[model samples]
Target: MSARFAFNHATAKFWDQREAVEACARAGAGIGLWREPVQEMGVAATAKLVRDAGVAVTSLCRAGFFTDPTPAALEDNRRAIDEAAAVGAPVLVLVSGGIPDGGTIDSARDGVRQALAELAPYARERGVTLAIEPLHPMFASDRCVVTTLNEALDLAAPFAPEAVGVVVDTYHVWWDPQVWQGIARAGREGRIASFQFADWVTPLPAGVLTGRGQLGDGCVDFKRYLAEVDATGFTGPIEVELFNDALWARPGAEVFAETKAAFERVTA
Candidate 1:
């Protein structure tokens, strides 16, 4: 089980990219990368760094704030797909942008559908899968409007599974009564592109952007989630992707070590 643990860069938002890669390499773990750090390091350089370190990049953090789907947004998503390919990451996790200006939630969802149609083929051609992530409903207004696995799957259904898929992040979907059924559906359709883990804690902080709880410090049932995902024949990295501000304030190496331990404990 430990062999499948992966560290997502955002968990240690302030860590140096090179150091993070080295740490993952030492632990014999995979990594989930974010676009900004990759861009700052130069995609080519980052690719070589991970390659040389013998670290596998499980997925790329994002590239889908296209509720408006402007020409620039589409182009940026295209670049993200390209970057994922360069870094040897098979999945590009996408968070559909919230409601656009003057648009209702329904309209925003339609925009997501349009954006995926335009970008799925591009992603496929680059050998990357666009994995749509549904945030918790509380975030439906500003961070992501697609707030359930079922909704995400509906958006992905039009495209080939190879081109589009969904992310099953524990923090966001653990409360959904229908999540199990949704996971089964995603698996049967061969659309489980990414499986991320983040615990859900109560009394969410102001804005709630970076309040993801550490693995065992909250309410998530990691073992059960593992069982369901494993039953799906999805044998991929289980990325630890917390967004806690407290973790960010600490030294990254310390957070990384602690997170790795917690992951092993919870998932063991």
Candidate 2:
């Protein structure tokens, strides 16, 4: 089964936001936006840009990190939800933050549970779905406490499917032995909110934040992912979100074209 494509703006982190939107618009593809760029352009203006260009905003990159759930953290997430609604984005992707200082992963995960309970109603009221993204275990210490789809699904279960769901990014979950089962479960639970792609590469970089490989450049078998997710009856846009530093350094238009081609070739 062939999947529709969406370009995640982070794939070209340095590209002008308008240019990225225009590129996606020209290609008749969907786009996933990050909050920083949207805020930098002003949410209303960014909304107008996409609306005018006739581009679809598949999901908003983030709105979680509640290891602290500070008043500020929740406030920021509220604002993110508002931004997502303003831009007509149905899903707000969340990376449950890492453990707080002096705290264990278990403790931090508790905070995420509490935060979700508090925010789910708010998000649902606004018709925005908060998609919990389980980052790879490599980032468990610093980036996200949610390191597995099973864990993400568990966290999202207490809430209604319309308010909370899980993000399936191949780069993050492909290594898990139970990923296929996890995908099946997400489907049965009606919680597969967003599906993203980025291949895994080796020789860990210093930060490990921007080392994502192109679609076919690494070990991710995207065909398998498409099959598994499609078998579950999910026909949403498959967003390609590479964080490779080399791709970010190149012209965004070229990167977009190349990434789209890679996505087509792998899913073909």
Candidate 3:
């Protein structure tokens, strides 16, 4: 078993949270938690569940949407930071929201910067790193505006590395020609708050958000990614986050077994 393997809750979106944590515990794998379920189960209960199971909480997904940066938005992010802290998750993934009705992409990017400035200090105080996740460019208009690892790193640059960092998710960064360089740079700057795995497959399903390919099922070179990230001296959990509708429709235990096997195969 790979000591670094972790299963992201989104990989089995509809699975029961307790069952997921239990599965991770049995496998000696860490777990990435989602906010909705955590809130559903109550933060304290979820914390106790994982603690009793001895399952590591690798990272929390998600708490960004900072393009607008209203007071309400910033408040929500702070709550997210607290949740991450309570769950013992060191990082909280952030997805910059799309451009507002009157804002341009540049302005939206600025909003992200401003929001980080306001949130980084709070996050640092809580011992949580706010990780900026750059979604693919296609999502810029409606999902996320930060579209590359370099851009995410730049957004994180103004803050202390521990307070703000970038998430290197393969589904979003694999298309970048300079991805390897960005990975190396992230390592050098110690800004890699989280490292995630997902593959790219052709003929993407409608609404590409759920089209993430399983490990070894697409074009991404996992071995190379693992080698590069490992060379950076990042010995943290390696989370596999898939958003495939097909997988979500299956029994979560079955999907977990298959995905774990795929991870071992690809990383082997």
Worst 10 residues of 3 by lDDT: 202-211
The local distance difference test score of each candidate is 0.94, 0.93, 0.95
lDDT of 3 by residue, 44-125 (tens): 9999999999999999999999899999999999999999999999999999999999999999989999999999999999
Model 2 agreement with the true structure over 1-268: per-residue lDDT tens digits: 2238899999999999999999998888999999999999999999999999999999998889998888999999999999999999999999988889999988999989989998999999999999999998978878899998999999999999999999999999989999999999999999999999999877766657888999998889889999999999999999999888899889999999999999889988
Off by over 4 Å in 2: 1-3
**Model 3: pairs clashing at backbone N, Cα or C within 3 Å:** none
Show where candidate 3 strays beyond 4 Å.
none
The clash count of every prediction, one per candidate, is 0, 0, 0
lDDT of 1 by residue, 7-99 (tens): 999999999999999999999999999999999999999999999999999999899999999999999999999999999999999999999
Assess candidate 1 and give its lDDT.
0.94
What's the TM-score of every candidate structure? 0.99, 0.98, 0.99
Candidate 3's TM-score: 0.99
User: What value of lDDT does candidate 3 attain over all alpha carbons?
Assistant: 0.95
Please give the TM-score that candidate 2 achieves against the real structure: 0.98
Better of 2 and 3 by TM-score: 3
In model 1, which regions exceed 4 Å deviation?
none
